[model samples]
Each structure stands twice: as C-alpha cells, then as structure tokens.
Target: MNTKVSRVYPRSLTFGDTTVELATMTAADAPALAEFVKTLPVHDRLFVRRDVSHPKVLDAWIGALAQGHVTSLVARDGATMVGCTAIVVDPLSWSSHVGELRVLVAPAWRGRGLGRALIQENFALALGLHLSKLTVQMTVDQRAAIAVFEELGFRAEAVLRDHVKDHDGQAHDLALLSHDVAEVQSRLRMFGVDDALQH
Candidate 1:
C-alpha cells in the first residue's frame, strides 16, 4: 500500500479523437490554469467551492498544491487545459480518512468521456492515499455528472437545500454523493480487478 510506489503521473489518454496529457498540478500551471478557469461558464463557476476566477483564490489553490493539502491533476490538450480534478483532504481533521473529490471539465469536453477518465484516476488516487471514503457534491441540475459518478459506484449521500448561490443571488440545491473506497477496494480485490485499476 505504498502510494509513492504505485501512482505515477504525466500520463496520456485519448477521449474520442482528442489526445490529452494528464499531469500533477504545479505552480508553473498557474497561467494556463487561470485562463482555463476563466473560460468556464457562469453556471459552472457557481458550483466551484471557491471563486477560482479570482487571481488570489486561484493562487491559494496553487499554494495548497505545494503544501500537499490538495492533490490535483490537470488535463491538457496541447497548451490548453481541458479538465482538472482535486482530491482535498485535511490530515489534521477528524475525517482525515475521507477525501472530497472535485472535478471540472471544459464545456467542449463534456460527454466525450474525459470526465469519466478523470474520475477513474481520482478513484485510484483515493485508494492510494488510503482514503476510506470519497465524496462529491454538485448542483442538482448537473444530472449528467451525477449519472457518471453513480455509474462509477457513487451513491447518494445527502442534499443541501439552497446550498449554493449564483451571481444574481439565486439559491441552488447541492446533491452529495459518496463512494465507499474500502468497500470498493475489497470488492475489486475479490473480483480480481486490482491489476486493471493500476493503469
């Protein structure tokens, strides 16, 4: 269960006809990552936990990456970032064994299987980190995302009514989904899918 020995980054994957490079996020990615976040639609921005559109907020995220509080993967098509993910954890907190998963894909990349790839990557990451549980929350309107997560074995956990606010101050409900990483790993081991998850 040595994560450092098992997980490797700076990999490549093909979604549809597009080839993308997935790498661990670094300070050098700030510029391109900033531009990518800016291109996200308002609706997409609404669900992000922080206002990543702001330079300071985005900078803080980069700092977190260096501090190891957040482990992220940035998916790039050439020089442009098409998708990204964050597995946030607080080792000092009571729920240290749990990680909150956040994923964002550009509008053009949706429905092309990039998100699924990212999710699967994060699943391996969570397992490597020894996380027993993983959770993801998104606006209720994101039915497609919910479906993808569910298909990957996440189940409904809870709903936070009027949890998020839009620019116009409208409220939106957030649906939280969780995956039991321990249970999944056990099942995968039982089914002999352990080797397949590594790649």
Candidate 2:
C-alpha cells in the first residue's frame, strides 16, 4: 500500500491475544480512562500525571484533539483498556508542522511491543494530519522508554534538568528526543506494521 493511503486509513490491528483498536476519547470514555489510570503502578502513573482528584486532568486530555491543540489515542484489547497516547500539536512561529509526541504504556503491557505499535500508529495519525515532526520526553529514570524512543529513530535533542515531577513530588530532568516524520515513517515501513508478539 502507498504510504499516504495506508497510514491515513485507520484499521484494526492485532498483536498476540491483544486486538488493538483506536478511537478519540469522548465523555463516555472518561470513566474507562479513569479506570485505566487507577490500575497503573506508581511508575507508570507518573508518566501522565494521573489524578482523578483533579477533574480537569481528564477534561483537558480528552478534549485536546477536538479543541484543535492535540491528538489523543486510546488503545483497547477486546473490552479491556490497555493504554493511551497523547500527541500535542501546537503552532509556533518557528515551526507549525511539527507535533509533540508523548506516550505511556501500561506497565503490565510494557515489553510486549504494545508501546511500539501505539507509537507507530499515533505517528501515522499525526503524519496524516500533515505534521512533519514528533518530540518526546526522556527522563533519566525511564531507561526502557528511552530505548523504545531511540529504537524508533528518535534522536536526543536536549536535556532539561529537573524537568518533571516525580511520584513523591520531586523534580527531575527530562531528555528531549525528536524525529523527522518522514524518517520515522520509512523506518516503521522497514520494521513492518506488526511485531513478533503478534505471531
């Protein structure tokens, strides 16, 4: 399939026993999203700053895309909610074609290639929207997340010390990684649409 058409069209994908489907969040998904976060471990929770006490957290995330500021993707396996990815695309005087990429995979689902699939799918979605760049945060503690981002062809752009808040409310540095959209798409095509966990 040609890159544009293949990626622009959304299709259901399967990986192992997991059937991954994509959808924009609605008010109805708020409950599932809340539930999804409640089940996450502390380490995983910090990535997205989970806080039900703050209703605005869900409000801004679920509505960011429709609000024309960001794109959010929810991944599901059967009826079980697995993970969510949020892509922030904001306009800037320097460059409006780039979209910021941020993602979090459920801790239990980590190591099963779910993160890669979610990222690639999200990347394609962002590209279909005409974005040409994607950026992600890389904290010193998140070695695994860093590896995944690097493997996906993201390059380290900068390191901002004390850039994020920890679970205990401590600040830490965040490594910024970026990838050219065209390069990421080409790499995923070479890597194929599915990984071994699927077979």
User: Once superposed on the true structure, which residue ranges of model 1 sit more than 4 Å away at CA?
Assistant: 1-5, 195-199
Tens digits of per-residue lDDT, candidate 1, 5-99, equal 24687899997677899999999999998989977888887667877888998999999888777889999999999999998888889998898
Clashing pairs in 2: 162-172, 162-173, 163-172
User: lDDT for each of the candidates?
Assistant: 0.88, 0.68
Q: For residue 19, give model 2's deviation from the true position in Å.
A: 2.0
Distance from true location, Cα of 149 in model 2, Å: 1.0
Q: Write the per-residue lDDT of candidate 2 for residues 106-174, one digit (tens) a residue.
A: 677778888898887776666566677888875668887888989978888998888678658888777
Q: What lDDT, from 0 to 1, does candidate 2 have?
A: 0.68
